[model samples]
Target: MASGDLAVGVVCLSQTVVGLMGNVSLLYHYLFLYFTGCRPRSTDLIVVHLIIANFLSLLSRGVPQTMAAFGSTLFLNDIGCKLVFYVHRVGRGVSISTTCLLSVFQVITISPRNSRWGELKEKAPRYTGFAIFLCWLPYMLVNIICLMYITGKWGNTNSTIKKDLGYCSGEGNNEISVSLCVPMLSMPDVFCVGLMLWASSSMVFILFRHQQRVQHIHKNDLSPRSSPESRATHSILVLVSMFVSSYILSCLLQVCIVFMDNPNILAVNASALISVCFPTLCPFILMSRVSREPRLSFAWIKITKSPKPIINM
Candidate 1:
């Protein structure tokens, strides 16, 4: 293998391994909590869904890119390509949708009791399962388009115009199909991203107003400890900001790939790397949030010193 290919392969491998480990660890913790009869927070369910989606995204995108980088060729057949691409798209869609749902749900959870959204506070957790089902259902149905357009390396040999995606190829001969499919796939993502941005902005404004109130209430105290709501909001904002940055950069690289007559290996590798950043980082962010919660410590047991009988040491 070339030196550059070796480097790309190593990086991709490291990303896949680390992402999978983080996601699995988080998943196990949540599952353990559920089975052990601990009552989890309302957002815990949503976070679990997010972890599963991230796991799928990393496995679908990272593994193949790593293999291709290490100089593997024609390893997958038509069915394999279709399945991999479909799973990746589904995972990507669900990740965005779940994040949006989490943000909106938090906004509802924290709204003032007299406000319109306040009514949802008691009812939101009841509908979390339905909301998650909705997030997965549409994406699973919509991304079937991938099955039609994608093919393996050995398939579609006669097609003169195709987009090479390392181990798989996208047949782009029909202009009409390309035009229709691209928009159909992208519209949902754009809509979800818009919702996330709106939700994040609302959270920021709410936090600002809340901080002002705290400062006013504690005028003499210079450093008031933040509330749990503030900490959770901050974490979500950080997650959303990271997601947007990575998503935009990945989309730009994909656009470059689309416009180029032949995209270089570097561009393709970079795009794949950027696309998985949010998934890789998401678990760690949430883990930090979980650790900060006083009632939900991950240690599972508290160590306390015992009193010794009256013998002077």
Candidate 2:
């Protein structure tokens, strides 16, 4: 293998391994909390859904891309290519949807009781499961088109019309189909990204107003520990910012790939790497926030308020 290929393979392998481990550990933590009868926060369910989506995204894209980077070819057949691409698309969609949901939930959660959003605050948590279901449903149904257009390298007889994706090829002969599918696929993403941005901006405005109130109330105090709401809002803002930046870069790379007559290996590899950044970094971001908040415990052995007497033994 070429040294460049080796380097790319190693990076992809590292990302997949790291992202999988982070997401699995985070998932286990949440499941443990649920089984132990710990009452989870309203946003916890949404977060769990995000973790699952991230896992799927990393697994489906990272593994194949890594193999291809390492000079592996014709390893996947027709069915394999379709399944992998479909799963990646669905996972990517779900991730965006869930993140948007999480941001919107937080906005509702922190809204003042008198504001218009106050009504939604009471109802949002109750429908979180339904909302997450909605997130998964659209993508699963929409990305099924991948099954028709995507094929493995060996299955691609017409090199002139098919776009080679290293291990898989996508039929590009029908401009009508491409035009329709691209917009159909991208519409949901665009909507979700817009909502996420709006929510993030709302959060920033709320946080700023809140800070002014605090500073006015305590003029002598130069600093104060932020409230849980403030901390959570800050975390979500960070998450949203990272996701938006990564998503934009990935989309730009994808557009380049789509427009180019023949995209080079480096461009493809860079796009794959950029696509997984949010998934790989998200779990760590959440974990860090959880660690900083002592109230959100992840203790293996829950401590009781009252102990039994030892004299009987």
Candidate 3:
């Protein structure tokens, strides 16, 4: 790398790290406050889990790329390639699974008692951990092909397109090039999209139903601004909504990465921008939930200020 190129890389890397690290630190502090002092609710558990997921996502996807941006370019040298990529793949896979679990858990949590899903809702906390575990299964198993196919080889004009940052796979003259494309090209993206939709839809439906019931029950007595359940629901919904948006951006960016195969700095810039910023949003999403004060002040007072009930409606 030339001196100017190295200088630019350093600035880019420093900017990325500073932004993400600051947000991540805020996430940790809020998590500590919520876990140690705040009310012990199941929602707290899910948020905590989301934080963990975000941490791993940063470690897996963000760290390596950041390092490559500022540090040495030629990494994962023959053996290191598989190791770095393998660890990073597992991290990204865990991130995807965690988001899926987040959606499912919220759906189950908000389901009505009269609904058939009530039984499943009760099982949510117990199974949340297990569901997160289950999510890692496919990503890990299928990504074995990455280890087999990828190596530390530079791509001149002759190489397969890459999706992930600091992730060079099926590049250069590799034995697994022809072997891996069938599964890589079709299966993974389809599977992720399908599962993401299924999880998100179920959650949205349950939340919508819950909110409608709340509004109807309190009809014309709308003196109270909001309910605790409504506020909690809103928080989770926003968090999941952010996840959904990030996932869409990630998928599209990956597609773009594949489409712009040739060495164009514009493609590289857009792709890098997405890859670097993706995981960073996870921390911000969590922090956003914490910073937003509960909208249901009356509901909170119902429990906290039980001695005094001011009737207006």
- Runs in model 2 deviating more than 4 A are 155-161, 298-302, 306-313
* Candidate 2 vs 3: which has more lDDT: 2
For model 3, residues 15-44, the per-residue Cα lDDT tens digits are: 457546855676666555553344445555
Q: Which is the winner by TM-score between candidate 2 and candidate 3?
A: 2
**C-alpha local distance difference test of each model:** 0.84, 0.85, 0.57
Q: Ranking by TM-score, best first?
A: 2, 1, 3
Clashes per prediction? 0, 0, 2
What's the residue-level lDDT of 239 in candidate 2?
91
Q: In angstroms, how far off is 101's CA in candidate 3? A: 0.8
lDDT per residue as tens, model 1, 1-313: 9999889889889888899999998898788677544678889999999998998899899999999999995889989999998999899999999999989988887778888888888999999999999999989999998798778896457565467888888665566876787788888889989999999998888778777777766777776677788789888989999998898998899877766656776898899998788899999888877677765343343212224433587
lDDT per residue (tens digit) for residues 102-184 in model 2: 99999998888888999987788789889999999999999988789878886557766457777787666566876887798
Better of 1 and 2 by lDDT: 2
Q: Model 1, residue 219: what's the lDDT?
A: 78
Candidates 1 and 3: which is better by TM-score? 1
lDDT of 2: 0.85
